[model samples]
Target: MRQTKIVVTSVEDDNFCKCRFCDKKIAEIKNDIMVPSAEECYKNGNVPVPNFGWFCSQACAVNYETKFDINFAKTKEGKIDYYL
Candidate 1:
């Protein structure tokens, strides 16, 4: 039999940090929340994970992505449209 190695993380989300996806307060990682993976995010219209704190929930991430995409649109003539 062989031995296996395990890794542990000390990283903790800032209490004051807000979810980039929803502006909701980020709960402590000690609470054992599930942060969505980048690949998983793409399925919901390419949501972006923050460089720091994560989203409050997966739904918020999806909503955030779609809202961002709504800012732009394609014209009938294949032109890029930007909206405020």
Candidate 2:
């Protein structure tokens, strides 16, 4: 009989607690309110861009920027174009 090794994967229950890959503390909340993930609060570049926060890092930021900005710009100009 041949014995096979089984690999077990562990997933942390707290998504907002820290980075699963990096194990970095995302945020510190004193109140009872829930804290947002680092990817949600900071851009992939680690910059805090409110209303559009995302995972901040070289790869993540570039991916998000190209996906959202470039794709949106490809669309026809809308009525609000003059304001922009």
lDDT of 1 by residue, 1-84 (tens): 343221213244453334666566443333443333333323333322333334445565546558877422335753322110
Clashing residue pairs, candidate 2?
Answer: 43-55, 43-56, 44-55, 44-56, 44-57, 45-56, 45-57
Positional deviation of residue 51's Cα in model 1 after best superposition, in angstroms:
2.6
Best by lDDT: 1
Q: Using alpha carbons, what is the TM-score of model 2?
A: 0.30
| lDDT by residue for model 2 (1-84), tens | 443222212333553433323345554433432255333334223333223322333344445556667321221532111111
Model 2: lowest-lDDT 10 consecutive positions: 75-84
Model 2, which residues run further than 4 Å from truth? 1-25, 28-45, 70-84
